[model samples]
Each structure stands twice: as structure tokens, then as C-alpha cells.
Target: MMAAHGAPWFAGWGTLALVNAGLAQGKNRSGLGWFLLSLLLGPLATLLLVLLPKVRDRMF
Candidate 1:
């Protein structure tokens, strides 16, 4: 768990890079917008990520 949390500095940045790449293909920029917002709003970001329709679709 410690490693997992620490992974965010590098790994999480990588994940965000990939997600940003994917978002770039679309016309709507809100996906990236929300992500940047999350960095400032941690729990809210987690909640927003959790509540996203597309994200939730994949989890279960």
C-alpha cells in the first residue's frame, strides 16, 4: 500500500498522461478539465472519478 500510494508521483502522472492523450482525441475538453480540477480537490476528484459514467462502466 505504501508503494501504491507513492506510485502516484510517477505512476499516477503516467496514468494521467495516458488519460490526457485519450481525452485529446475528443472534441469535448471537459474530461481533462475535470481531471485538472481533481488535483486541487482530492476527495472531490475521487468522487468525480468514481461517479463518471464511462469510468463506472468499466469497474463493474
Candidate 2:
């Protein structure tokens, strides 16, 4: 249902962040950064994922 509706903001974004954070770590660290960001950030993570870059570029 959510997959069909393009509501993958939760899974996909978390996965992407997790992978990126893991790659950023290079093999020593676990996915703590990923889990922390995804957990603490919550829906704000989604908002930040979508908006942070643009906000940084002053696209707002």
C-alpha cells in the first residue's frame, strides 16, 4: 500500500541514510549514526532529508 503510494519516506530514506553513513564510516563503525539520525530525527528526518539541502542552498 505505502510502496504503491510512493510513501517510502520511512524505509527508503532510512536505508539511504544508513548506507551513506556506513560508507562514510568505511568499516570500523556500525550503523549507529544511521539509527540515531533515523530514530531521533523521526518525521523531521524526512523533512530534513527532503529540505535540508535546498535549505542549505537557500532554495527556500
- What are the TM-scores, per candidate, against the unseen true structure? 0.33, 0.34
Q: List the residue pairs that clash in candidate 1.
A: none
Q: What total of clashing residue pairs does each candidate reach?
A: 0, 0
Task: List model 2 lDDT by residue over 18-45, tens digit each.
Answer: 6545543443333566457766665565
Give the clashing pairs for model 2: none
lDDT of 2: 0.53
Q: Give candidate 1's error at residue 25 in angstroms.
A: 1.0
User: Which regions of candidate 2 are displaced past 4 Å?
Assistant: 1-6, 27-30, 38-60
Q: Model 2, residue 20: displacement in angstroms? A: 2.1
Error of 2 at 4 (Å): 6.7
- Tens digits of per-residue lDDT, candidate 1, 17-49, equal 446534432423366665566456545555545
